[model samples]
Target: MFALRMSLVILVADVWAKTPFMSEYEFSRRRDELIREEREYAGHLRELTADEKIVDNYLEYLKWQEFIATEDKFLPSVGLEGVLDDIVNSKVFKTLKKFPKGGNMHLHENHILSKKKMLDIVFASEDFEHLHVAVDVPESKKWRLDFFLNPPAGWEKVKGNPKYTKEKLLPHMTMMGSMTEFAKVNPTNSARRWEEMDPMFSRLGSKVIANVNIKFKYLESYLKAALEENVQYLEARSSISSRLYTLDPDPKYNSTGGKRYIDETGGEYELQENIKFIEGFVKKNPEFIGMRKIVNSYRGASVSEMYGDMEKAVRLYHKYPSYIGGFDMVGEEDKGNSLLYFMNDFMKMYDNTTGKSLVPFYLHNGETNWPDDLESSTNKKDPVGTLQNTYEAVLLGAKRVGHGLGFFKHPYLLNKLKEHQTAIEICPASNQLLGYVPDLRNHPANNFIRMGAPVILGADDPATFGYDHFTVDWYEAFMGWGLRLQDLRHLAINSLKYSTMPKEDINAAIKDKWEPAYQRFIADIKKEACAVDFDASTNAPAISRIAPREGPMKRSTKVYVFGRNFEEGICKGVRCKFGNAVVPGSYISGQHVSCNVSGLRRRNRKGAGKSKAVGVAVSVDGGATYISYDGQFTFVRNL
Candidate 1:
């Protein structure tokens, strides 16, 4: 029996050898190739243009330099707060700031302007006279601002008050002060983070923006700040309910039931007022493409309250179809009533069973790092678990999901999101700072982006978080995810692609507005390569020597300039200066850069026309600075 088994085994081996089956190594090699192809497929949405490819190479090089910088530290190991200063100062981040990020799709209206900017605007306004601070409260609860027609007993006006200096007022108005306090307790405790964060709105955001006088100016400043940061569009989530009132002096005005102030506006009138304000803003800043309002209600509300809010949102949508973007529930998702708790309320917004939802939902779901089982009960009476919200959000037809920190845990939901082409609005800085993922590299948006799910970067409550504009979030994602330029371009395009903007308008903006601005930016950056007079600063490239020191100045001569700390990338602003003439250069490595030594502006010297030893310098940061070595280049009659 043993001899027969051996004979069978030998026969099987002979057959396998004759049939030419692949070896394990060969199989692995082929599989590896497929994996590489799939990775590229996942990373890129579309083929990059020639100019975009150039920028991509430059961005890759900039990323390499960032990894090498010692004090800047790698972004993943040190959280965003740890490296905020470095990111703001990074050359890569500076260039990204210039990028025309299409829209800030998922921000609250009150949080648009930074607290510092908000305070500055308030101090400059006439409302400063009536604006009073609640300083009598406990140390943690101080610096609440509100407008009063008649001064309450303890409330004090801000003007000339020694107590409320800008520096003193800033920390209370922004999250940084409270964030520091929260960190001292437990940095990773998300509940603690939210505990510190929630009251900030009541104290700073709601109180200040509730004043009618500040709302318009605050929005104007937001739009202006967006334009300055090259953001052409916005879809801010705002509650257009009836609370805004301007302070006034007329005694008869008190009879109008203005809630302690005159000239009150709310509900439909408030919506119209905001629409008018936006229209005026767009008209004034033509470069600012447009703005839309995503009417939002807090998720913490009871079902009846949420239903009323949803009904009001639908009415507003119908009344101002062009101006309203969608509907959402804004707040800390983990502690709020789950989407399941409002399923019936959401379903009521639709009719005929198959009819589309009257109010498009842009729900903020899965904004927590909590496990699904932590609060498994979907009952309204019970505290909610967040991951289930992602499921309900998808089921309810959310146009986009905000945060989505826990979405990756559900494979089915992730597939459904991709199938629906629903975008995820990722607020990296907010996520990191709010204690969801201290290491942004572990943020679920990374997986969402890799899986080809539509992803847009946003700043959620930038002001409350002590950040301004969308670039800080962009920097976080770019660094944390190791994003390529193609990824950024894809995200920029996705901002409009997934926006509430109509299809035709989105296409028009992309073709006529965003595309032109993008191309112009590329052109400008490229052109900046040859400009001279760069401000020299720390970390500037230091030259060692030049290969073939002699070259003809009249014609183009390629010379390799050896240097340390030389930036590698497409020469956006990087240049090689020979005497007075600066020319575009190609970055070779940390130690070498090559430049076309042509058109050297002949220096006015004693040796008028002969070969002269000229100083050669290099600038890596858009002529912001230059570095030169003692080794000189001879501009000869001929090489």
Candidate 2:
């Protein structure tokens, strides 16, 4: 019975010993896996370090991705719909929701009127004559009088009887095309027909020309619309060329006729009238900020003529410092003499004590994309050079630059502008419509903003373009430039910051009004976001990193390995074994930094064979960089 019991005991002991051996073998397999993973991770790190350019590119890509994701989260919730409705209807609109509209820098007085208003002005004018109907061969058919009646000494005369109304005039007018059919060959007197029809059509056509009286009426209505849309300021280009009430002698002298009508009326009277009207309206409703002057000389005028006009403008400024704000050379750039032609006169006017510049000068410098010859027909020697004239204007001390569309093409000038903190007024829709650039996205304004240029947004001529200031321009800028609410707010602040308004007033508006409004907007956005539930675990996947290992060796060597998590929280620890025991050191986690294994040493190596080494020690910290690896094997080091 004792011998049988001994044999059973021996059998049990042998089975127990075999169980430990199985465990060590499994542990050894795992150790091999961990070492392979470590080496692969080290290889990846080395590769990334060697190619910094690639890493930088990747980082930039990551930044853009983050920006896009952030925009996705924030943009949709902005009160765009509410803002639009408010722009259309609100009477007391002070802010443009989140948009920062700069100024109406490119408005021309003649184009501000509606088509209906223009038609009314033409039809209602008591200036159409119903005299003997005569047809001209080349230009126009006209109803001419035997002799033109001159007005009394003080009052200007009308072409027709003052009693003639729109109802009476519709039957007398004859429309013609292809000039040849319009002119009847007067067999009796060729010279008489030519002379009579020439002056007749000229007089009749003057009524239909862009009228400034209609423009003033249009502006009154438009300003109300703009105020509802929350437009803060306007600077319109006004000219004395066509609206002068006073008469001048015709340049072409005639022996028989003493004087004929010339369209030379000093715009000062009209300017003053407009100013008074605006001031009176603003007094009742303080939301309407006043207007600034941009005196424009026609480009078709001679150098002397332009200089004379400019001189007259200076006199106007001197006469009414508060009303006439600044001076500008206006008209088609191609038709006008180069601005350089009047540089001497400009300097004289600029330095004049009598007409000190109360308002800032903003030049419409380079509005062309064509070659110099293409820009001008009369002066074909390439007078204005390329669009680089904008830079020259800046050097000559223009406070603001208008239609600086060629900014990107001049890098040095761009850099100079950046250095000088000069702002560029971008009119995206106007530029596109006028054939400056094709698309809003490809507009150089985006490039300017990205390159850190001080940029302001403007509506060149919203009425002419068949759009409102807010909808077409502000909306396009928002969609095209990828601008966020904060960016928009900053743009608004910038507009006020660079405004010609007094510094004290700007500060009051910013501190007392805009800042609080912006804060409320941001708070509202955050409140809306917080009410929603977010499940990051379902939305975002976990990324893993391999734990690092270190050991004392004859020389520095790198190991590499690769692995992926097939399931959530699957990444665990590395294990090694020797004889009948299992050992563990390194570990990895999805959320935190992985453990480092350094100062690891193999014991019982030669006797047990390389594969059956006893045990290894590791430092969880980087060697020398964070921890020391002593000869004595220890898992923990005293910091």
Q: Which candidate is the best by TM-score?
A: 1
Q: Give the top-scoring candidate (lDDT).
A: 1
Give lDDT for model 2.
Answer: 0.46
For candidate 1, lDDT tens digit of each residue in 1-639?
A: 999999999999975764442432234344546767777757564666656655655566566667778334676545555566777788878888898889887888788788888888888877777778876776555667876666555667788887788887887876656566546346577877877777687666776786777878888888888988899998888886746676657676555322344324455666777788888887887777788889999877889999999988888888788789889988877777888888789878887676889989898888877788786335458565777787787888888988887888888898898899889999888887788887677778888888889999789888887766588888778877868767887888899999998899999988877888888877766555323122232255688887667765565666777867664334444688888878888765556677777745545433447677788888766566777768787766543
- Each candidate's TM vs. the true structure? 0.77, 0.52
Segments of candidate 2 deviating more than 4 angstroms: 1-102, 113-216, 241-265, 352-360, 371-378, 508-639
Candidate lDDT values, in order: 0.75, 0.46
Q: Which whole-number lDDT from 0 to 100 does residue 107 have in model 1? A: 87
lDDT per residue (tens digit) for residues 296-329 in model 2: 7765566677668777877776777656656676
